[model samples]
Target: MGVFPDFDGLGGIGDLKQVIGALLTVVLIVAVLMIVVSAICWALGASHGNPSLASKGRIGVLVGIGAAALAGAAVAWMNWLITLGSQL
Candidate 1:
């Protein structure tokens, strides 16, 4: 048996899963957009000698990429934790 609780036989969760998938897709798209915008902002700030704007843009880019990584890895991380717990 899997380490995860037996939600396999549960009814109606398919819809919830679909919704979650859709939301994840939306988040990914937005995060990518943010990264693009931040890159442009950083370029403009550097060209204009605005350190503050450049810093903010760099931070935004990092945050957007971090969020995207988390969203992508959450399920794998959760499964890894569960497997470790079961093995212990």
Candidate 2:
């Protein structure tokens, strides 16, 4: 007997996948925007000799990068999980 995931086992699963894809797209767009804005803030802060703003901007940039990475990896992560689950 073959044991595999039945992706069509549920109704509205296609719609759910589409929604998740759209959300991921939005997240990536926002993350990129965040990085751009943060970089600009960092430059302005550094030019103005504002250490606090510069630090905040740096943190924001890092967060944006992390968010983008996570969003990008989400699909792979989920697929990995599903594969692992099926192996059990």
Candidate 3:
């Protein structure tokens, strides 16, 4: 069964697929924005000799990138997992 129940081809919104697609799009956009902001913060921190700020920015950059990658691959990852699970 699909994780989201369809109600007249829409799952609480206009089409479940469209809702998920929009959500993923938003996530990607936020992740890209985070990367840019973090990079700027990293540069500013390093220039001001603030190790704490720099470290936080660096961590944010990494996490944002990882999140973006995961979101991008979520569909493929889910399909793979489902296939593997069915085999087991």
Candidate 4:
């Protein structure tokens, strides 16, 4: 009677969780990339003799990188939680 094989179903929020997980994964990856880019931009923006400017730029870049890395880690952890929850 059915067009395809019988299955339990996705009537639950399984699909939603999967979508959230994928989104989180993407966010994590993007955050990491942005962190790296931020570091590079700081390095390139700094020129010799500008101690104050270079120091400030380095600090800002490091802070940005740290924030991005933290966000990325949180996103990755959330994604993992979603997957584990889906399985169980």
Candidate 5:
């Protein structure tokens, strides 16, 4: 009576757990990478003579935020899909 436990009929939150885990893993990796990339961009921007490099770094931070948000949404979508799939 697990509803959607095991696709193979073994058991567990079945596929939902794996789906969430994958999404979270992607988000975490992206977050860490973006943080490092942002720091580098800022540092390079500070050292560079051109104004655009600094701007690019600032853009990196903004993009990082966007990426994180997108990742979160993707995770949520995945959750929704799982829920929908289970109902089916």
Candidate 6:
């Protein structure tokens, strides 16, 4: 016998999926915006010779990148887990 996820096993699962998808979309948009704004800040800081601002902007950019990477990887991670579970 094989085990797998039953998407229809619960009531309102479809709606839950929709909500999660919307949340992910928002996360990606915000992350992209953060990257753009942080890059601009970085440029301005460097041009004005402000080390503090530049350092903050650099950290923001890294955080934005990390957020995006995690958001993007969520689906793949979930899939991998499901597959791994099924093999047990």
Best by lDDT: 2
lDDT of 3 by residue, 19-61 (tens): 6678789999999999999999998999999999899999989
Q: Model 1, range 24-71, lDDT digits (tens) per residue? A: 899899999999999999888999999999998999899999989988
True lDDT of residue 10, candidate 4: 40
- Sorting all predicted structures by lDDT, with the top scorer first, yields 2, 6, 1, 3, 5, 4
Whichever of 4 and 5 has more TM-score, that candidate is 5
Select the stronger candidate by TM-score from 2 and 3: 2
- Residues 26-86, model 6: lDDT tens digits: 9999999999999999999999999898989999999999999998798567557655654
TM-score of each: 0.72, 0.75, 0.68, 0.45, 0.62, 0.73
Candidate with maximal TM-score: 2
**Collision count for each candidate, in order:** 0, 0, 0, 0, 0, 0
Worst 10 residues of 5 by lDDT: 2-11
Badly placed stretches (over 4 Å) of model 5 are: 1-20, 43-49
Q: Candidate 4's residue-wise lDDT over 1-88, tens digit each?
A: 6686333554655666677668767766775665576566566667555556566667766776676677667767876876675575
Q: After superposition, how far is residue 19 of candidate 6 from its true place, in Å?
A: 1.5
Model 4 worst lDDT window (10 residues): 4-13
Question: Deviation in angstroms for 6 in model 1?
Answer: 9.1
Query: All candidates: CA RMSD in angstroms?
Result: 5.5, 3.9, 6.9, 7.6, 5.4, 4.3
Alpha-carbon lDDT, every model: 0.81, 0.84, 0.79, 0.65, 0.75, 0.83
Better of 2 and 3 by lDDT: 2
